[model samples]
Target: MATRGTQILNPRTGQRSVFLQTAQDTGGALFQMETFHPAHNAAEPEHTHPFQESRCQVLTGTLRFRVGGVERTVKPGEAIVIPPGVAHHFWNDGEVEAHAIQEFRPALNIEDFFVAYFALARDGKLSDGGIPKSVLQLAVLLKAYDRVLRPTNPPRFLQRVLMETLGPVGRLAGYRPDYI
Candidate 1:
């Protein structure tokens, strides 16, 4: 399980996350972290948390966010709240590194998902766009973290079909669902 002070670095995305209050610390009420995002960092894939709400408070530099198709630039001391099941993505286009305090309500296994995803990146198993290079790996990760994260494109039903079909094959090929 995640604990305060645990850190994960993703070189592919030039981002680092340090856990502040984990599920254990918060009695499953919230998961909090401090994220360091380098300048010009790429935005994450448009996605949604099916059952969790997220909030991010900018600490330094500027962060750009696209929430539910609306774009906004957030600066220091500003915060953005993303409701559950909303499609959103964020990036840092400023010349300086950006920092933010992020929180997720109804703490789930988000930290585990991050650890697994970043591990793949650290192991050089992800592409330049921060996606798993292998279809099997992608299936495994997507299937495992479906409740916490879901890609916005390709449609939800399509994703479900693919994950349901390929997930078993990926697991049979020795790709376990939980990397952490």
Candidate 2:
């Protein structure tokens, strides 16, 4: 684990990511961070987490959220909480790139996923449109997340469509996290 006294650094990739363990003195417990995806989209599904709950705050662009059997729209500066074990999915519903702060409980190994994705993305390891393939492996990896975190995405078919179809287009459309 990174020491709490360590200083965090920002990457040129456009993210201000930091480790909460470094903030233990500040009463940090939840995994929190702001993310900006330059023209990104989701291959997400209506799913739930077994233990984790998350919140999304739209800082820019339109964030379309579907959760708990209801669909809601969140604009800039707006937020929504997704309780654990409720079906949910979302996407950037705007012309410009989107920005949002995603807060997750227990700081679930979610950051590990992004770290891997960005590493691959940096090396052009993703498939057509930066997805690594029309079929996103990330979604597949996330499917197993059901055993660890609260279910957040939906079914595999729906996830396939969102990740393979929608996610690819977003990546091809210049959906680079740091670029936004």
Clashing pairs in 1: none
Can you write out model 1's per-residue Cα lDDT over 112-176, one digit (the tens) per residue?
88888888888898877777888888888888889899988768997888699998899999997
What total of clashing residue pairs does each candidate reach? 0, 21
Give Cα distance to truth, residue 54, candidate 2, Å: 0.2
> Cα RMSD to native, each candidate?
1.2, 9.1
Model 1 is weakest, by summed lDDT over 10 consecutive residues, at: 171-180
Indicate which candidate wins on lDDT.
1
Off by over 4 Å in 1: none
Candidate 2 per-residue lDDT, tens place, 68-175, comes to 778777888899998776777766655776677777776555555445555555565554433444244444444434333433324546755665555555656655
TM per candidate: 0.95, 0.55
Q: Model 1 misses residue 158 by how many Å?
A: 2.0
Against the correct fold, how does model 2 do in TM-score? 0.55
Off by over 4 Å in 2: 1-28, 117-180
